[model samples]
Target: MSDTRLKISLASDRGMIDAALVVLGTVAEHCSAPLELHFLGHGLRDEDRDRLAHACDAHGCALVLHALQDEDFGDAVQVNENIPLVAMARLLLPRRVSGRVLYLDCDMLVQGDVAELFELMPQGAALGAVRDFYVLDQMRPGSERPEKLAWHSKVLGRSEVEGYFNSGLLLLDCDVIRSDRALMTRMTDFAAANDYRYMDQDYLNVLFDGRVFYLPQAWNSIWGRDRLRAKTLAELTWLPDAERTPATSKVIHYTGPNKPWKSQSKLLALLRGRLPALMKWRRAASGRYA
Candidate 1:
């Protein structure tokens, strides 16, 4: 028998708990399959956990929370102030969860039936993700930041940097990730040993590299400042000649420092305009979109 329930995972701290719920709720509204939800973090208020559990229960899904202490990580890796230790909690998930898990950052917004992602598999790969728009732009000819291109190339450890993927949305093969603990450990070690800029992103991209199945941009439609030339998965040269990104993006991942809740921002309008499904879901959530 095939167990097809979608297992979704997320990690965050007390600070982002509210926002994570909003993301999770929105995902649930749009996703049709039975869900197995997991949240890993510390400092969450009881209400937060209760709210999450209730929501999942209402939808008939199991929600698991792993509460941790600061010492739990125990200096596993060093992080800049911008990214807290909780960012590394994802690496610990292989031991904590089983099967293929879709690990999403709390900052994302879902606009499609995410269950559709399961139709694709990691194959021989450890995970799946979308190529970063910013990284690809940086590697282009006469790019504004040649140093970034050089650094990304160095981090990737080969002349080819096109395969580099964004870690914001990962379709992780936990079986593979669990089996490759030694290699995954090296990812954390590299972050601790160097001035790694992108936190977990650097860890995954550098570690998984060629081992990732680059999913469609629609699954992780990057909402960046650059207005990346390729919006849909089919537009990207790497994808097959089909509607991968789709006319309407499946997910819209807001990248960079300026997040929606940071302040009154124009992105809210973009969200309202581009994704009718999200707008309806957001209306029911009632102003959490801010």
Candidate 2:
């Protein structure tokens, strides 16, 4: 048992199969830790499973499938949404007494050693998330609506909430997560009751308010229009480069409808140029060493 090696998992429906594969390929290339990929939800068809298995074999990583039982949440309802799938996946993952498990969304791509995130784990927190940039109390001129504001307030659990987090990436202490079913139940209940503004993110903010450790924005950078308008790729400090490569990024979350796989993102194009070669080298290295 290697203490430094971490177990990582992703939750996704069938629509994210390609994204998940891309994410896995990226992780296998960049991370030096032992990796585990779990597929949750109904969309994981047989063909998808076979493709995932082939990818895992190519990288010498373990891939497992744990179908969510209706009994797990006491509901026969199937959750195809990313937010709820994320929450349910964390709650149902197999427990490990000592090692850490990092839960990443399918939309993310890794650029560095994710094992480093385990070392930065806070003492009492069961999970960690990066703050979302769009969580503002005062809505933009055209975006403001009383109902929307009220929904955001309820989702955040308060109107004056600080630093709303993006729930696409999470680092969980397996020991704490396995034992904290009560908190998981509470989160589920909150999601069921609230017409959440941001789905799972809203539930997480309301449940783990002020408890989750705030990591650097680089960990889950949103590559949307606003970020591009605020700063160009040259000005973006988090991008890996000759002089300023990130020392502590565990994952790179591509949150929102826009993703690197799509043709619209300039940032994705830049990353795609670099990530594939790295992935190929890692695959060869793993074959030789593992």
Top lDDT model: 1
User: What lDDT does the true structure give each of the candidates?
Assistant: 0.69, 0.58
The sequence of per-residue lDDT tens digits that candidate 2 reaches over residues 4-55 is 4467777766776676777778777888767776656544678878877888
C-alpha root-mean-square deviation, each candidate: 3.9, 6.9
At residue 286, give the lDDT of candidate 2: 52
**Model 1 bad stretches (over 4 Å):** 76-78, 140-145, 187-195, 224-227, 231-244, 265-290
Q: How far does residue 95 in candidate 1 sit from its true spot (Å)?
A: 1.1
lDDT of 1 by residue, 1-290 (tens): 12767899888888887667777876887898878887887777888787778777766777878887777665555556656667777766777888888888887778777787767763556788878767666655544465667867777787677777877788877787768768756644634533567666776777786787777667776654314535322244454543244645677775555555554445664654433433443454575432
Q: Point out where model 2 deviates above 4 Å.
A: 1-4, 69-88, 94-99, 136-151, 178-181, 190-194, 224-251, 262-290
* Clash pairs (backbone) in predicted model 1: 233-245
Candidate number of the best TM-score: 1
